[model samples]
Target: MKACIYPGSFDPITKGHMDIIGRARNLFPKVFVGVLNNPAKRNLFSVDKRIEMIRRAAAGMDGVEVVAFDGLLVELMKKLDCRIIIRGLRTGTDLELEQQLSVINGKLLPGAETVALLSKPETYFISSSAVRELIEFRADISDYVPKEVADMINGGNAK
Candidate 1:
């Protein structure tokens, strides 16, 4: 079965992320949502918590598996035996960075292909950082993230 890796920090797994995952699921038989565990960066949610949030957000998504990973994304792809990388693009700035990563990943893993899915206009401006800021201010995030995630964040579960 063909599979693709959709890798991200996914601190809280926003709706935009889910949207991309759904889109990727439509193309690939198996979609592996690789949650990056970057210790260098301080995350609001623990890796395990993030995984749980993703699982709840993607509860009924067939063939969608949430897994925590560290190190290079290509390494995770090799481990998953997947050659395709699924990314969500919201703007030109995101495109520039994602394109660069795609080039580097292609060089690292020969035959690797990165597929960029443009975010829907409604969700184009929603980002993890933005959500974090909203949380800091105790602002509403129901529209940006799934209900489960919003509850987790508002329930004082974040670090």
Candidate 2:
């Protein structure tokens, strides 16, 4: 079966990220949303929390599962027996960074490839960092994230 890996910190899964996940699912038979666990990075939520949030956000989706990993993303892709890496591009800077990473991944692994998908117009302006910032200031984020995620962000009950 063809598989794709969509790896990210996912400090908090934003609506934009969900959009990419939804789109990736339609293309690849199996789409694994790999959440990166990097201690050095100042992530707002724990890896487990991030994974839970993703699971909650992806509750209704089939053939889409969330997993956590550390170290090189290509390694995780290989571990999952996937060759395609899904990335969401929302800006020029993202393109540049993604290009460099794609080149590096290609060199590191012969068969690995990166697929960049432009965000849907509605979610083009949304990002996890932006959502975190909004939450930090106690701004309403109902539209930027899933309701379960929003509740979790506000320290309220979340299923």
TM-score of each: 0.97, 0.95
Tens-place lDDT per residue, model 1, 16-129, is 999999999999999999999999999988999999899989998999999899999999888889999999999899899998998999999999999999999988989999
- lDDT per residue (tens digit) for residues 74-136 in model 2: 888878888899999999999999999999999987899999999888999998899888877
> Judged by lDDT against the true structure, how good is candidate 1?
0.92
How accurate locally is residue 153 in candidate 2, as Cα lDDT from 0 to 100?
A: 76
For candidate 1, the per-residue lDDT at 69 reads: 91
Task: Quote the positional error of residue 5 for candidate 2 in Å.
Answer: 0.5
Per-residue error for 127 in candidate 1, Å, reads 0.5
